[model samples]
Target: MKLKGSMWSCIGLATLLMAGCDKSPPISTAEEQPSAPKKQVAFQPDWVPKALGSGNFEVCLSNEAEENGVKDLILPVGMMFDSWGHMTGSLRDSKAFDGEGTSGFGKSDQYALALTARVHLTSDRPCAITQAQAVTHQGFRYRHETVPASLHYNFSAGGLYLNKKGGITNDMKGPAGDAAQIGLLSGTPISDVGDVYRATEDL
Candidate 1:
């Protein structure tokens, strides 16, 4: 699919979630990137090249479970802090980040929760994320596997929703949406998914 805006393919989530200020160069999409043969795909998370989840690499594997199967990508982010280093509670409460969401109504959210996403790959079944897309509160589609020069790639919530009638507050948190075309692979497919991805590069 043809996409606009900054795009990061293969392996770049760790850099996207990094806590620094240096700007990264703009990332372009793999519109012309050749897809790997299904037989030739390699499914490797960050540990092989470096220590697991070290530096700026995120291993994209989640625990297969009896519950919480609504999403394949889930993580608990630390509460946001403002410029003065004051705690920003949750996205909705932080008026500094007021925006609209799926609801299309402008209301401050009462609660927000960044669920814990442990930093290890529990299941290595390289998934073919058949259909995935993410956007911002103001409705900007993004494909960021790594952090952009803007410093954050907080996507408007796709799969997950807020607990409140006025929840989630329309702030950005990344989540590669549905694995619509899912199938198990012994190795990684040239991952064509996320808000994410690089052109089949090392993590």
Candidate 2:
């Protein structure tokens, strides 16, 4: 009987030792694990058009932000209107403007679209442009086309009269004008024109 009891005690000790050896530490949860930092994304502006007139047609800018930090300025040329005041077609143009120059105010970084449109207006009614809407890419500023103070507009001639800044005007009229022009006396480089649409903000 003594020998049998001693054997049972030895078996119990061995089992306990095996169980202790097989034990492992608890596993970690997903919340306890460290996560990598998120990357920063570049900012981009939405293509939403502000109200310009009683009609739905309005001048708008491109929401696309170029890598060189240039935004295209969109101008409304004209929109086809039915007899009932409904819009049938929209005509518009765009010019790339560099907001960042040696000075905060920069020139047109690219050629401007020759803005022209054919609208069927009644003889009694004359369509008039009252306001213009300027759009810029998100995270970018707008640079207006600069003209010499001497430049002036002549409504009767229907043409821009430029002096002293002749080269600038010539550049604006050239096939490869590098800046946007703002004035009544100069003709924009005539090329392909694009339509302007409302911009949506990118989150």
Candidate 3:
């Protein structure tokens, strides 16, 4: 995907070049950089990763059902949020698939849920992501894994949303709590997902 305002990449590369240059005149130890103080960026709620229900669906059911039969899929449609309050990730993932067997054949049975649109994320904080594509091992049941999700800001709203890509917002209307939902299936329990965001903030 093409990113807007990618000149930052050039600037970063230039910085690396200057740092690595050997032809530049050697400087006295005192004249050299003492090392820059680590920057501590202030957090903002807007930049926190989030999911806003777009009231759309993005799933397609084919003619296939399990022994117990199956129901048409119901997927969440929403936008991903960055610390800049912009959408950051794609909504499609493995969790979107849920159904039993062989029900999509009939005209009445086939259904489709598609990503309608996404909001743009605007932020200066470096986004942290853990792509499923990054998984080193595959097809192992009960294998323990903890992937980075989102950047935290408030350290209160549980810092920021993990999985900067933003998760599915299954419940548009709330009997569930929170302004946004995190994690897959949109149907994941609010408390659990929220807590994960919170705990990761400490790191």
Candidate 4:
């Protein structure tokens, strides 16, 4: 993929979500005291990766199921953000295959899920993703794995991935074409997938 002329860098935040318990007693003063003004953080708009121009791309799914079983392939094609800081995306049903044991007859179905956004960068600023994670929303649990460097974006912190088992793997892989190809070809069982959600100093 050809990177744009703009220079990008990655900033690793120790925490994405902040939570705390108020242990101190509540103030009971009749007179209200002035409070300090809160700092206003600048808002930055998310940008579509150069590879996915206009934020449109086709999610390819190859039938890799054996000749005697049923298999399904799911992938993310669009991305969006919720009212909260959390990022979300739509899923695409790429292909489904039903193998015949002895009738020599089988069925193969192919489809695509059009998405307005498929990748969610944590920040608009340039940053390289040091980790990736596979977050399952449904179906059987699969092995987690780290994303390849080819897909890492200096501007985007992470992305989304849909597994065959009907689960979304968040920040688990880069959006690069080659990285997607590797995921499809590796045939790595979900049980043996490694964890790539943690930070990696090396790109």
Per-residue accuracy of model 3 over 1-203 as CA lDDT, tens digit each:
11111333576788899888856786587667777653444433343234433322111111221111323222222222211111222222212222221111122221111122322211221112211111111111111122123322111010112233433222244311122222212111111112112111111
What lDDT score belongs to each candidate, Candidate 1 first? 0.23, 0.23, 0.23, 0.23
List, residue by residue over 1-203, the lDDT tens digit for candidate 1. 10101122322555655625557776788686876533312222331222233222122322222123423433333211111111112211111121222112222221111222232222342222222311112221212332221221112222232223322332433433232112100111122222421111111
Q: Top model by TM-score, which number?
A: 3
Q: Please count the clashing residue pairs in each candidate, in the order shown.
A: 13, 12, 26, 19
Query: Candidate 1: which stretches are off by over 4 Å?
Result: 1-61, 64-203
* Candidate 4, poorest ten consecutive residues by summed lDDT: 102-111
Residue-wise lDDT of candidate 4 within 1-203, one digit each (tens)? 21111111111121222213444577688788888654333222232212222212222222222221213323334221101111111111111111111101011111112132333222221111111232212121211232222221111112334434444444444333323332221111112112322222221
lDDT of prediction 1: 0.23
TM-score of decoy 4? 0.21
**What TM-score against the true fold does each predicted structure earn?**
0.18, 0.17, 0.24, 0.21
1 versus 2: better TM-score goes to:
1
Q: How displaced is residue 67 in candidate 2, in Å?
A: 34
lDDT of 2 by residue, 29-117 (tens): 86796866443222222212222234212222212113223333222232111001111122111212211221111233211222233
